[model samples]
Target: MKTARLCAGLMAVLVLTVSGCSAADQAQNPSPTSAAALTSCPATPLQAPAGNGQAPQGPPMNELKVPVDTSTSKVIDPAGAKQIQCGRTQLKTTDDVAYSTATLANGTAKPLHLDIQVPAGDSAKPLVVYVPGGGFSSANRKQTLNLRTFVAESGYVVASIEYRVQPDGATYADGLADIKAAVSYLRTNAATYGINPDKVALWGESAGGYLASMAGVTDTDPKSRVQAVIDKFGASDISKLMADYGPQIEQGFANSPNPIGQYITGSPAKSLAASPEAVTAANPVTHADAGDPPLLIFHGDNDRVISPSQTLLLHNAMTKAGATSTRYVVHGADHGDLAFIGDPNAVSPWSTEPVVSAMVDFLKATLS
Candidate 1:
C-alpha cells in the first residue's frame, strides 16, 4: 500500500497577497445588491493574535484558552427564537468531545440542523462552522462526524450544519440562505453556547466548500461574516462548471434526469432570475471583494467532478481584490478522497489524519 504524499513543496506557493484594493477601486466596482443583503448587522472587530510574529507551534491537540466568565453578564435568551434552539440530545463521536444537535433555522421545506461539538473543558472558544459536501443534493453532517470530532478535540467548537438540498426542492439561494441563517443564529446565541462570535471560521468540502466560498465573499452583516474560510475542492463558478462539465454531468447522472439542471434550477423564478448576462452571478468569484475574509483553499489536480480551475479562478479573483488567500494543490488526488485515502479508488477510507492536521493548524492560526 502506498502512503499519501504530502506535496510539501506545493504548500510553499500557497500564501499569496497583493496590495489592498483602494476606495477608488471599490467605488468603481460596487458590490452587488444581493451580496449586500447581510450587512444590516454590524460584525464585531476581529481579535488580533497575540504577538504579531509567526504563531508558536504547539501540541497537535492543545486546549484552547478559556474565555472570560460571562455568567454575570446579561445573557440573551435564545430558546424562544424560531431560528435558534438548545439542550438537545447529544450525538456520538469517535472522541470524548461533547456535542449537541440544534435547529438553527426552520426552512419552508425542512428545518436546518447544526451538530455542535465542543472541547472537553472550555467556554467561549472560537468556532468553526463546517458545511458538508454533497453537491447541494444531500446533507453530509453525519458523514463528517469524525472530522468534526477532530476539530473539537483541538479545543475549538465545531458546528456541522444541514442546509436545504436541491433534491428536496431547494434552490442555491435557499441553501445559501440557510447557511447564512445558521451563522446568524450561532452568533446570536454565542453567549449561551460559549462561542467567540468574532473568531468564527467556515470550513466545507466539495459542494459545501463552494457554499463556504460564497458565504465568505457575499456581503452580509458583521454578525454573520466569517473571519476565515477553508474551502476543500469546491466549485466556485456554477456557470463555468456547467460550461466545462455539462456533458460529463449529464452522462454521469443519466439514470437520474437532469441532476445538474435540478440543482441550478431550484425554482422557476430563480432560474429566470439568472439572466444570460448574469449567469455567473451565483458564482462565488462574482462576489469577491476587499471586505472578504481570509481564505484557505485545497483542491486536487486530478479532480474530475469539479476541475481545479474552479479553485484557481476564485483564488485569482481574491488575490486581485487584495484579500489574504492561500491555495494548496494535492498532486494525484482526485476530489474528496485524496485528502484521506490518497488512492481515489479506495472504498470509503476514513483516514484523513494529514488533512485534518493541516486544517487544524490553519484554524488555530486564524482563529487564535
Candidate 2:
C-alpha cells in the first residue's frame, strides 16, 4: 500500500539525514528553516459548517469575455472541445493560503497553507482545490506544479493545498477536516481572490484522491460543498484494502521501523478503535447518495498499489445510490501512473495528454 511505502521512504530519509553525516558536517550544513514559518494568513478561527448535503450557491459569475462552451465531446480527445482555452497571460499566483493557527490532531502547529494561481481573466472563475498524493504521510504540493500550471492556464483559479499528513499525527478524519476548512476559507474570501465559490471542485490523486472522494460524499455547509470532484487512483475502502493486501502490508511493516508503528500497534483496543477499516468505512462510497456532486474518477487498470477495483466499487455505489459519477480505467497503467503525471519511476503505458484533457473537459462542463 502507498502508506507502507510512504512509511518506509520517510524512515529512509530520516536515517540518511542523521547517519549519513558527522556531527561537524551536520553543524556546517543545517537544515533549512521549516516552510511552516512562511505562513502569513491571519490566525482566524477555523470555521466549518455542519454537513447538510446541500449544494451551496456561490455568488453569480460575471460574464466571461470568452464564455466556455459546455458540450459533450469524445472523451478520448478532450482537446477537441472548444471550451479548453489558455489564458493570454501568465497566471497570477499567491502563496500560503492559510486557514488555521492552532495545532491540529497532527502534532505540528504549523498553519495549513495553499498556493493559489489565478488565470489571467478578470472574471470570477471557478476554483479548483488540488490535493496531492503522498500516502497520507507527506504533502507533495511541489509535485503537482505541472498539473497546477496546466489547469491554471486553462482559465480556472487553482489552489494547491497542503493538509495535515500522517507523519504529523493526522488521521483520515483530521485530513478531511483540514480540506473542509480550506474550502471554507476560500469561499469566505472568494471575492478577494476572484473566485466563484459555488463552482468549487476538489481534485486529488492517490491518497489525495481518497480525501477528495470523502469530501465529495460527506455533507458540508453550503460554503464548503464542492460542485464537482476529480479522484485519480485513490483507495475507496480501507477495510477492503486490508483484506486484499494483508500480506503486502505485513511485509511493509516488517521491512521498516515505521514511525507510525506505535500509532498502529500501541494498544490492541485502541487499534480497533483506529483501524483503517473503520476509518475507511466513513469514505466516499459509504456516504454516496443522491446529493453528491458530479464525480469523475480515473484509475489505472493495472494499479498494483491501490487496485482499480476500488474505483469500481465507488462508481458502482454512486450509481446504485443515484448520484452522478463517471469512471475511466486507463489500460496497462499502474497506481499514480495514469499516464506520465506522477512518480517517474512508475510505468506509464498511456499518454498523459489525453488524461489531462479529459479532466479539463470534465471541470469545464461541470463548473461552467
Local distance difference test values of all predictions, in order? 0.56, 0.61
- Model 2 sits at a Cα RMSD from the real structure of 15.0
Candidate 2 accuracy as lDDT: 0.61
Candidate 1 lDDT: 0.56
- Candidate 1, residue 157: Cα displacement in angstroms equals 0.3
- Candidate 2, TM-score vs. the true structure? 0.69
Candidate 2 stretches with Cα past 4 Å from truth are 1-89, 105-108, 242-277, 337-351
lDDT of candidate 2 over 220-260, digit per residue (tens): 67868899999987767644432233454534443444433
Error (Å) of candidate 2 at residue 67 is: 43
Candidate 1 per-residue C-alpha lDDT over 325-364 given as tens digits, one digit per residue, 9 for 90 to 100: 7777654444553222123231111223344566778898
Maximum-TM-score candidate: 2
